[model samples]
Target chain A: MTPLAAPKALDSFFLEARCKILDLAAILDRINRGQGAGAVDNDPRLDKIRKALEVLHDQSGGRAERIQQIFSLDYDPGWDKPKPRY
Target chain B: MYYIDPHIHMISRVTDDYHRMAYAGCVAITEPAFWAGFDRGSVDGFRDYFRHLTEVEPKRAAQFNIRHYSWLCINAKEAENVELSRGVIQMIPEFLNKPNVLGIGEIGLNKNTKNEATVFQEHVDLAMKYHELILIHTPHLEDKYKGTRMIIDMLKQDRRLKPERVLIDHVEEHTVRHALDNGFWCAMTLYPTTKCTPQRAVDIIEMVGTDCIMANSAGDWGKSDPLAVPEMIQEMKRRGHADSVIRKVVYDNPLAFFRQCARWQEWPAETEVEKAKRKPAKAHA
Candidate 1:
């Protein structure tokens, strides 16, 4: 099976998403660290997943934000309309 | 002149509601994806639903001069089917940046099972990934207590959540404090049949100080009303609560929350032209 790479917009999204996931993993580590190491059901392999999400979030923040500026701009809230004169 | 009902189901409501809302001065709204008492089977079902929520409904409300917005998610009751539900959920981000799609949910527990847990976590991940607000739809009936517990526990795991940005819906007398105590904004649905009532909600606000509490009708196939906010406001007034308190819970709270979304940034206040357009519409209605 071929690994699917993201489109420009989706890549930006995945990048930011990966960052948050890693941040979450860090919190889990902090808790487990304080709980004296045996508190969590640990799998050392999960560290790879955590690191990847962190890297993606950081790298995507720059590129995806630029692409989002070009493609994902939105304007639908009723705020821009002129206020009614009663 | 500004009050936002952050969770109101207008799909089951009427054009009269649009008029009523504008007249009562509804500034904005957020409709969560909720059960309509029947199962919606397939991704196409949710696709059509999300489109209606984002497109058709907002257009209808525009004619009445009310700003409409909503959340995109697989309803929890339907989330019972994990694979089928994820297929629907996976299609959500396609519409996430739509004029109305504020967040990934109205997603939380129903039967408090693992699939509910699985989908809830995925919904949280999507929300965190997108940096969008999460409007969690907690379960109803006796299952609500256990379900809210699961919702909080899972949320505690997700570090991306700010706690304040997570809105837990369908809170009752007992679980209301738990949701607030945990630092999450709590939304109580003022349904006629099964959820919290308006007077009781006021009592809650009185005790809880209306800090992070808000109300919605969440009117669906079951009996409900879109006027639940105004009714609650009137009740709070009748109870002699200060006008500032009334504005906080019924008005300012939701306004502040909806404006946090990047999509609602473009909404403008109604103008003379919009009023001119509204006059003809009211006569027709």
Candidate 2:
């Protein structure tokens, strides 16, 4: 099978997305600093954002691979395995 | 240009979101019971949530001229607690007759566990007893395909469930056919991330053609867009899809599905100009 060429537009798209992420992180940092420790504590939204950022930071793949993984609907056969209870 | 968001978590959204949605040409929305970002400790929490869905959110949406409908269920995430799920399921009938209450929904699998499946079947049994419409939520990411398959199998096993009355939501390319081919309705959720984008949703429509298909924002407390259906409309227009085609996917299809509700009232089909000429009056609660 022929490998798909990367879309040229996505280069700028990802760059712009990264800038927005950084800008959001900066704003959140500023808010945290201004609010001090008490205000940040037990805020579920902040915790969720922090966890999402950690997941992004922990991703090992390149941007193209990550984008494909995020958007594609390809089924994983391994998902048939039994999952643990929440 | 008016549309119906067949599924959204409006309780998680603010009043301004409803105002913006009304301005964006949304006439109606149906919110399925979903995970409240965290699990509740007792059945009383779900009871209050149900009251909020049936009582409060409807009034809130009405302030902006948007009709609000809701489904009752112990969401799949919380279904893991089988005891609490059963209690919530038994209590669901108390609110099922509420004017704005739609049916049982957002009720499918989360982890594809045995307990989740058990609670799912019990919920199905209750819906069968009430003859209510069913709305399903397939799992996310890697679990979606298998989870959807499992849900389909379960639905098929229930002889009483008419496929057309059930809607399998969050269907993507690989999972869309499973829902449609079985004669059930399906929806694509347009989220900012981790779901169908507007372009992709339009592409799916082009591939599958618009039969029992629809799209929603699925906007919630998370990073999602409430204007996603409108975004899809713009994309479809840009791709030269006829206005009728866009309207079917966005407006007509959802109404068609929602019309099956026992309490659904038919609203008059009036043009924007016609609506404007009418005297302003308060909508019935």
Q: In model 2, what lDDT does residue B62 have?
A: 94
Candidate 1's C-alpha lDDT?
Answer: 0.73
User: Using lDDT as the measure, which candidate wins?
Assistant: 2
- For each model, chain A TM-score? 0.32, 0.46
Could you say which candidate leads in DockQ? 2
Query: Residue-wise lDDT of candidate 2 within A1-86, one digit each (tens)?
Result: 11112464365257867887889888787876784667676786566555555556764734332333343345443433332122
DockQ per model, Cα: 0.01, 0.06
lDDT of 1 by residue, A30-86 (tens): 867775566344654345444444545565443322322222113222212111111
> Over the stretch B1-285, how does candidate 2's per-residue lDDT look in tens digits?
789998999999988999999999999999999999999988889999999999999999999999999999998999888899989998899998898888999899987787888888888888888989999999887667778888888787678889999999999877888899999999999987678999778767877889999999999989999999999999887666777788899988999999999999888779888567544677999
Off by over 4 Å in 1: A1-86, B266-285
